[model samples]
Target chain A: MLKYNFSAGPCVLPQEVFKKAADAVLDFNDLSILEISHRSKDFVQVMEQAQSLAFEHLGLQDKGYKALFLGGGASMQFLMCAYNLLENKAAYLNTGTWSAKAIKEAKMFGEVIEVASSKDSNYNHIPKSYSVPSDVDYFHFQTNNTIFGTQLQETPSVEVPIVCDMSSDIFSRQRDFDKYDLIYAGAQKNMGPAGATLVVVKEEILGKVSRSIPSMLDYKVHISKDSMFNTPPVFPIYVSMLTMQWLKDNGGISWIEELNNKKAGLIYNEIDRNPLFEGFVTDKADRSKMNATFVLKDEAHKDAFDQLWKDAGINGLNGHRSVGGYRASMYNALSVEAVETLVSVMQELERKG
Target chain B: MLKYNFSAGPCVLPQEVFKKAADAVLDFNDLSILEISHRSKDFVQVMEQAQSLAFEHLGLQDKGYKALFLGGGASMQFLMCAYNLLENKAAYLNTGTWSAKAIKEAKMFGEVIEVASSKDSNYNHIPKSYSVPSDVDYFHFQTNNTIFGTQLQETPSVEVPIVCDMSSDIFSRQRDFDKYDLIYAGAQKNMGPAGATLVVVKEEILGKVSRSIPSMLDYKVHISKDSMFNTPPVFPIYVSMLTMQWLKDNGGISWIEELNNKKAGLIYNEIDRNPLFEGFVTDKADRSKMNATFVLKDEAHKDAFDQLWKDAGINGLNGHRSVGGYRASMYNALSVEAVETLVSVMQELERKG
Candidate 1:
């Protein structure tokens, strides 16, 4: 059943990407993907390509930027960032769970000064007008909140080096890639699968701290070794490199952003127009292009709406546990047609009323 | 050509396992394996089944043991153990590179007491007669040294809990699983690939430490979340599960261990008998059943040995950069026939000389 999958993470990859990835698994250059050593020249090329494409797609070439592929998720990055970068204090702008988690990790290393937060408003919007203190080590923020369906489309100017977690929205839009001192994204959304975490860092920002960073958590160590200090998640990184290739072949960031914007526009329009449905995030400007959350105006329509989508061969529409509604995550791999199919299901539910 | 792989890690997998894993990537239960939501019942089942099978295979059931599949390699685990388990001074028997790495990480969390070390002998053999300190939090050792090709054939009787980094040898042999408080393995070695790390911990041992472990490093948090604390290395975890199932279907560890012994014996005998080669580890008792290291009697034969292995369609035979000789890592998936092929190459090299 050729179902359109809307899984928020470990999510949908392009059909073509899947085809090649599968082929690689069986025989990647005559060595089964599982058989190839991470240290092999062929696999090292995969690592190099993954890193280079990451920087190139983000337009981060030769700007003192180095991209690294590592395992664990953004969750590990939360602590790793602090372990290597934090000195006396660091400032954070917390918008959602991931941002809050990052803030928690920073506290373990040094004093964490939270500049702003959106928790009081249920994280429906990205906190704006947050002050970045000059005295802090670095200013950290999540560019997008996956669960709350909001995004900071623009990187805020900070006196201290800017560190951003772009886990959910990395390749979905165009941005001034050089502004941030460090930017990291878990490869589950818009990039590749869930295993490899991508870190694009301005190299000069590292090794400023006095703490002895563990080899695994040290950004300097990973960058020095080209992310080969240990056996990397080869298959995931290989898949990510293939995904980056797909992104390149599909006309890079500007082309992808246009498609994503179109998909988000279609779904949001349906939610606002359909009398039976209402958008979860209150502000129209705050609605996420990646994860579009909406709920039925009447709980009575839930069953019919679910069944219609199920029949339409749709999957992973359930909202997060904290937010009980439907979330249609439109990553780079999701097509405008898939978004249209979801909108049609909503319209059908409204007509049934 | 169907070549045999002998890379230390991110190493070879069974051909049948490769075939199935490839098929799953394209379509798992009619859904793309890469596309499925981890929260979906299907993937949840995969996670649950993987954890349970790990405990079952280790004969750890009803032994207060919980299994976790986490991202990051054993290198990450080298820190994670200290974060959760190291409260005060911990005892360690440093055998080789991995054990030394683990010692380095443990020093970050608390005081570390080195019980013994084999570094004086360049890590060629495991140090014997190391005393376990009762005053320390726990006693730790590596079950197998991948680079040095040394194995601790018998578990030491420790007064404190035993923690083992079995990254290079897990599932290759039967062990007294209940004796250890914790056992960790990077899946790349004998299990699956280069991402998911397998951790089996005694539940009762946690919460005894006073330190606050970071969420990602917190075994309790991961155990509570069923190792889905983050997105997890889904592809790696899924592959490990498939490999575990393959292990069970192929008559489990006991059957695997017998074959491993045979392969090791064949290769080690060839190295000993061939006048051109000499075994690296003097003590047969200390030689790893999985990774067998050997060197030429003279370095002049290096080019010929390299070409002979290449012509025989073998891969990853070159030893680690630290110890430049040759290492044949016969993980569970590596066949005795492959080992025989390597041995035949050794014999041919001797004849040519």
Candidate 2:
């Protein structure tokens, strides 16, 4: 079936990037990238180029910050960050599923102080008034709650280092990168494919924890090896490089932010204006620009609406199993045209009602 | 330029698999697999089918054995196995660099007892003496040493549970699958690609360790979730399934084993017969059937021979920098014609000498 993808993650990638990646799979510089040794100069060049592009495009000039592409995804980083930084009690603001997972991983390594939680409201809104402990090592939060369709407009002002899991909202908007002591994201969502995770860490903050961290799990090991501590997810890093290059070519983060905002605006406006559909997330200000969650007024209409979208070749529009509604994730690579098509469907549904 | 790949691994795969994989990069089932949601039925089906095919082809009827595809490659399994099995000291048979690494990871979790080591022989041979302590939790070994091109012709008889890192020789030949309690291989070598690792383990052996293992690093958690503990390396697993299916379709392990034997025999015969070249491993019985390591008789001819192979479109023929000269990895997917081509080149070098 001919389909337009709006999946939350392992999400859509630019056609151009896909074409280039496909070409490289067969013959990466006349040798299959798959067959190329990770230690070889050719692959080293690939690694360096990708890393350079990522740092360059992000406009990160801080020498203290090291950008690493490592294994085990962002969920792995929750523990890694905690293991590396959380020696004493660490504070976390639980907003949604990912934050809860991060908190769970943190508690495994050290004393985790959940400063605030929106769980009482079913995580429909970002928690306010984080009570950071004076002895806490760092405060952690997910910048965008992927499952709940909520986002922290600005990182919580805290006395300690600010760690953020920017898995869903990374590079979607402009922010002072230096404010975050650490930021990490799984590449499957907005970056590239599923294997690699991007970790940006402040170098000075490491080596504080008194725990014997595994070399593979240690961010310092990756920082020293430049993320070549072991054979990395080479193809994902390569595809991510191409995507970042595409982002730069199309006028960097500023351009992407504008495009993303326009796309999000179109869909949010439609959801607000339509009577048949209701936005699930209570707070409009806290609503994610990446994933927009909504539900039809009549629950019966959900199945029919889903079929309509599926028949129209819209894929991955179903919300997470936990959320139980519709979530159209308009990630960076998702076209504005796709959002427009979805808006048209919503309009058609409203007219029919 | 047409290139022949002989890298120890991230080695060559079937050209057909590469072509099909490349096609899938842009569109899988008319929808880009990259864009497919992990929760979607289509991808779930992919995961189920892959697992089913792997179990079917491995002829694994023992419900106690669970097959899992995970991230972090074989190196991760070193820690995972120790975390799952080790209560006190574990026994290790150090065969090569990889075995040493496994030993190191094991030590971090518990006291690792060196049962045997062949490092005195420059890891040119697999150690024959293996004294698995009755008190030790598990005995570990690398099935095939990629660097030195030596393989264990038979499993070492040990009372303790056996854990093998079969990264380079998993499906190259058929063996009695019931011998080992656990076996794992990084996919880049003999399987499909670099992003995933295949782990086959017995269920009864887990939960014996006393240490608080990280959930991501826990085998029990993964086994409980059927390896869907997190969003997996979906594409890599899918491609691996296709490769496994290909193996099954082409008359299963017996046929592939016969072909692998032929390919290795042709290359080994040429190495032994060619006056200009000498096999590096010294012991004839210790020679690997997968990676055939050799060097030019005259050091002056080394560069010339390398260039000759490169010009003849042979790639990844260079041995690891740690152990330099040449390594022609005859993986299962490598065509017999490629081996014949390599043999012919060896003959031409001998004639030149």
Candidate 3:
């Protein structure tokens, strides 16, 4: 059965990437990819290609931006960003769970000003009217909220440097990549797999803080070594490189952005048209194209709806516990056909009613 | 021709583990291992089994020890240890590059007292005489030094808690696992591959530090969440679990330890007997069973020795720049036959000379 996986993270990746990654595991140049030294010429090529492809996709190649495929996920970046960048104060716009977590870690390094928040509405919408303080070290915000199903479609205009967490929506949309001084994304969603996080930072912005940073947490240390300061997560980075290649071969960000819009359109249109269902987020403009969250209007149709999706070979459609509803996370790898299938299931549920 | 891998780390893994890991990458539980959710029941079982097998091999199961498979490598633990445990001063034995790096990170959190150091001798051997201060937060030392090929056979008798970095030699030998309050190893060595790290910590020893610890850095937080604090390095952890299972199926540490000893004995004896080669470490007792460092008695034999090893299908025998010779790292997966092949190459060099 062809199952469409919609689990938030450690989520779906391209099938071709999986095949190539599997082959590499068994043998890559007469050596198992798992067994090669990270410092070896073969693995070095993998690292270099991965970094270059990341920049090429972002349209930030030959620019001041340095891309690192690091382990420890985006959560580690929460503290590492502060450890290296935050000096006295930083401004943060709290949109959802991840933003709040990033804010918590940043507070340990310096005074964190909450420029705005949408916690009162359980982060159903992105706050737009707040101003970031120019005197602050940097402005931090999440590009997309995975759990709450919200996204900031436009980058905020700020005088100071911008640090954006694009964990869920990176490479899935067209963005002014040069506008942000720093951008990070965990690979589980739109990029590759879990375990590696993609960090793109403008090198000039580092080394300004007075506090001595731990070698692993220091972006300067990693950038100087070309992201080989220590043994990297070899397979994750290779697979990510393969994924970036796949994206590039299929026509970079612009191509994926259009397909992603179509996927989002199919699902969101079903949620709005189906009298049996309702969208989770109150505002249409605040909706996340990556993850479509919705609930059935009539609870009596729940069992039929669940069976219909399962029968359609759908997986990971269950919503997070915090939000008692269904979530259809359509990452870059998720085809429009999968979204169409999901929409058909919803239609079947309404027809049964 | 069968190739013998002697690369320090991200090195050799069991062939069966590699095959299984490759299969899983393609499909595990009807989904790609890289694509499955970490919170899913299938992955949770894997995480649980991996943790249990680690304890079982260490002889620490049901003994108040929690094993965590985390990302960010052992270098991250260099700082995380101090963040979670170092409140006042910690005792360190600076044996080689890794120990010095650990000490450097620890100093950031609190006072680090180097009880002893072999660095003055260029770390050719482990220092025999060192008294750890009882007043310190913890007594820390590396079990196996990969660079210089030195191993501490005995657990340091300390009244304070003990923290050990067993990156190069975990699961290859038996020891009193309960003696150390904390143990961490990068998975690249004896475990599985690069990306994930194994951390075994005594439950009662945590939450003693007064400093505000980042959520990602806190051992207690990871313990609370069962090592799923965030999306873990899924493939790395899964492969580590597979490797652990492989070790257990083959009779665990005692079985591999004896094989490792025979392998070490074969190579070291050949190095000593051959007039062309000289062992790096003078003190036989201080020699590492995992990585055996050695050099040519005459630099004239360098090319000959290099060619001989390569002809015999040996790889990664080049020593680190700090130690300008050769380092044969015989981890758990390396067979005795591989060592015999290496020794035969040494014999061929002597015969030619």
Candidate 4:
């Protein structure tokens, strides 16, 4: 059975990348990627090349950024960024679940000022305005809210260093790289796999925390080792590099963004036109180009609609358990053809009704 | 080519597991594994089954211990264990690089006492005697030294809680589970992949530390969430579960130990009897059954001998750069057939000389 995947993360990846990764899993150039020592020249080259490609993709050459592939997910970075950069206090604008997780981790490290929150409205929209503390070490935000299907259309311009968790939306759009002092994303979403977390940091903001940090958790130690301080998640990073290469070969982020816009537009149009369904978020401007969320207008039809989608060979369209509805995650790798098929299914259901 | 992998960690897995993982990567039960949510009942079942199987394989039923698959590897546990358990001081047995890493992590949390050292012999032998401080929280040691090619024949019987980094030799032997209060291992060597770390800790020993530990780094937090406090390395854990299932089906760790001993004996015998090579570690009792270290008798012939092995489709046999010699890491998944092939290669080299 050929199924189209629309899960928020650990989402779809290019079939070519999967084939390459599977081949390497058994035998990587006759030396399994796992078997090769991290310090070995062959594996070092793999690390260096992965970082180089990431920087190239992000266009971060003289931006004073260090690219590191570390374990733990983007959730860890919320604490890591706070532990490494937050000295006295930090400010966070909570948009969704990921931002909340980040803010919680930040509070453990230092005094965290919740500048603004969308939770009052059940996080149906991104916060409009927030104050950035001049004394605060950094300001943090999530670019896209996976659960609520909302995105901050513009990067928050703050006086302090701005850190972002772009886990679901990174590399899907083109933006000025200089806007963020640090950015991190788990590879499972738009990148590669779940094992590695890709972090790009401004080197100067580190080494200020008074707290004793574990060597593995410390971004500085990873930077010093070139992200090979310990044996890295070799297979994940290698596949990520290949994914980046694929992204590059396919005309980079701008191309992906254009394609993503088309996919999101196709699905959103169907939801808006269909009488039985209505978008959950209710705000058009805040609608995410990555994850499109909708609910049945007649609540009784929800389960039947879900089954209809499942019967149509669509998987992972069910919304997060917390946000009980349907969510179609249109990540960069999700093909336009898949979106077309989903839209057609919705239309056919409407015609039959 | 049928390449034999002898890398200490990120080592070989059963070919069956690899094929299964590969099949899932492309399409897992008709949906790619990456496409599924971790919160899904299917993935949750995977975690439950893996943990249940791991405990069963170790014969750890109703032992007042919890099995957790975590991130940051065993290195993270060094700090986590110390932060959670150490109040005043902890004792450490210095065996090799891994032990040194553990000692370094422990120092950040509290006073760490080095009870014994084999550094005098370049850590080629595990220390025979160590003073355990009854006042300390726990005693720490590495069971098998991967780089130095040595193993502790028997872990020291200590009154305080024992925490061992059994990263390399885990699942290679059967052991009395009662010996240690906590045991942690990175799943790269014998268990599975490079991303997940396996932790087995007594439940009663937690929540005793004064320091405020980060939620993600705290073992208690993981235990509370059933190791799902954060998004886990799901794919790696799944692969680990498959490997655990494989081990269980093959008669568990006791059966694995017999096969391990048989493989180690064959290669060690060949090294001892061959005039063309010599074992690097001096003591007979200290040799590791997992990683065997040897040097060519004639220094000039090292390159030629290495090339000979490489040409024979044997890979990752090079020793750590810190110790310039050859190391054939016969991890648990490595077959006796592979070790017999290695012994034949050594014999052939001797005959050529």
Q: Identify the candidate with maximal lDDT.
A: 3
Model 1 chain B lDDT-worst window of ten: B1-10
Question: Candidate 3 docking category?
Answer: medium
Tens digits of per-residue lDDT for model 4, A79-176: 78887887789999988888888888888777999999988787888878667878888889888888989988887777898898988888898877
Q: Individual DockQ of the candidates?
A: 0.78, 0.66, 0.78, 0.58
Model 1 docking category? medium
Span of ten consecutive residues with least summed lDDT in model 4 chain B: B31-40
Candidate 2, residue A219: the lDDT equals 86
CA lDDT, candidate 3, residue A240: 90
Off by over 4 Å in 3: none
- Backbone-clash count (model 3): 0
Candidate 3 chain B: minimum summed lDDT over ten consecutive residues — where?
B1-10
How would the candidate models be sorted by lDDT, starting from the highest?
A: 3, 1, 4, 2
| Candidates by TM-score, descending order | 3, 1, 2, 4
Q: lDDT scores for all predictions?
A: 0.88, 0.83, 0.92, 0.84
Per-residue lDDT over B1-353 for candidate 2, one digit per residue giving the tens place of the 0 to 100 score: 45577877787888878888898888887777777777768788877887777667667765678888888878778878887888888899898998998888888878999978888878887777567888888888888999999988887777889898998988878777688889898888777788789898888898887778777888888888878888888777877877787888888878888998898889888888888888888778888889999887788777667667767778778877667778899887888888888888887777776
Off by over 4 Å in 4: A31-34, A40-42
TM-score winner: 3
Candidate 3 vs candidate 4, DockQ winner: 3
Q: What lDDT tens digits, residue by residue, belong to model 3 across residues A116-225?
A: 99999988888989999999999999999889899998889999999999999999988998999999999999888888999999988999999999899999999989
Model 1 residue B340 lDDT?
Answer: 88
- Please give each candidate's TM-score: 0.98, 0.97, 0.99, 0.96
